[model samples]
Target: MIEIVRTSDLVLLGFLQSLLENANIPFFVADLHMSALEGMIGAFPRRVLVPADHVTQARRLIDEAGLKAELLS
Candidate 1:
């Protein structure tokens, strides 16, 4: 899988998740459980990952949703 977006904003995460789900793109949110270790201080941002084959499509979808800035280079 390839990391597409990494963020500490839950709202943005939810929006990205919804965007991927609605588009039928498979994804995984990495480091989500780190919140417990970090005491919810947002020290570790969660990562949005998709299969390497889907990276391009996922990126395009996020970009089209006006979240291009949220994407990881």
Candidate 2:
């Protein structure tokens, strides 16, 4: 899997994931527990992932939504 975005905000992640799902794109979320863990630390970070082949399309959908994509290094 390839990560397309990373953030601590589950709300924003939910919104973005909904957008991708609505577009019929497949995605997997990782570090979900991190959100809760980070909340205690004052930051909840999660990740959105997809098959390597879908990475480009996923990234495109995110970008087209006018949301900045936090590409994983």
Candidate 3:
């Protein structure tokens, strides 16, 4: 998997997940369970990842959603 975006914004994370789901793109939210360890302080940002083959499409989708700034270069 390739990391596409890392964010502490739960709302944006949910929106991105939904966007990927609607487009039939498989994704995984890494470190999603870390909040328990970090006391839910948003200290550990979640990572959005996709298969190597899906990186381009996933990035394009995120970019179109006006989240280009969130994408990893």
Candidate 4:
């Protein structure tokens, strides 16, 4: 699967997951547990993954929500 996007923060990652799920876009998250732990123990950015097929639409939806994806129209 293509790595469309990456991010840290389980909360935000969860939000992204929910967004994708709600949009009917299939996805998978990687390094979630590891990253969350890292963020807690090391305070580093966590990372999440998404399928390449859903990248564009997922990004668009995220941008539309303005949750974390802040993109200009």
Candidate 5:
């Protein structure tokens, strides 16, 4: 998996997840449980990961959404 974005913003995470889901790009949100365990204090940024094969497209979609700043690249 390629780590695309890591952020503390849960809303942005959900938005991106939905965007990718609608686009049919498989993805995983890493460290979610860990973040929850940490109490969502903006300590651990949750990661958005996609298969290596889908990284480029996913990045493009994120970038086009004006979320380039959120992308890990």
Candidate 6:
């Protein structure tokens, strides 16, 4: 898997998830429950990951959606 977006925003995560789903791109969010362990202080930001085979297209879609800045370098 390739990490795409890493953020502490739950709303943004939900939006991104919907965006990827609508695009038919399979994805996983890592560290989703870490925030709870960290007392919801945003210390362990969640990560959005896509399969290695879908990385390029996923990145393109995210970029086209004006979320390029959210993607990992």
Leading candidate by TM-score? 3
Q: Point out the worst 10-residue segment of candidate 6 by lDDT.
A: 35-44
lDDT tens readout by residue for model 6, 3-68: 989999999899999989999999999999897689989988899999999999999988998999
In the range 1-73, model 4's lDDT, one tens digit per residue, is 4454565445766777788788898877655567445546635544444576766776778778885453222
The whole-model lDDT of each prediction reads 0.95, 0.77, 0.97, 0.63, 0.91, 0.92
Root-mean-square deviation of candidate 3:
0.5
Q: Report residue 27 deviation for candidate 3 (angstroms).
A: 0.4
Q: Residue 53, candidate 1: how far off, in angstroms?
A: 0.8
Off by over 4 Å in 6: none
**Candidate 4: 10-residue stretch with minimal lDDT:** 41-50
**What is the TM-score ranking, best to worst?**
3, 1, 6, 5, 2, 4
Q: RMSD for all candidates, in order, please.
A: 0.6, 2.2, 0.5, 3.7, 1.0, 0.8
- Please give the clash total of every predicted structure, in order: 0, 2, 0, 1, 0, 0
Q: Can you write out model 5's per-residue Cα lDDT over 1-73, one digit (the tens) per residue?
A: 9899988899999999999999999999998898657876888988999999999999999999999988884
TM-score of each: 0.96, 0.78, 0.97, 0.64, 0.92, 0.93
lDDT (Cα, 0-100) at 43 in candidate 3 = 96
Clashing pairs in 6: none
Name model 3 segments beyond 4 Å from true.
none
True-structure lDDT of candidate 2: 0.77
lDDT of 1 by residue, 1-73 (tens): 9999999998999999999999999999999899999999999999999999999999999999988999999
Output the better candidate (2/6) by TM-score.
Answer: 6
For residue 16, what is the lDDT in candidate 2? 79
Q: How does candidate 1 fare on TM-score?
A: 0.96
Q: Spell out the clash pairs found in candidate 5.
A: none
Q: How many collisions between residues are there in candidate 5?
A: 0
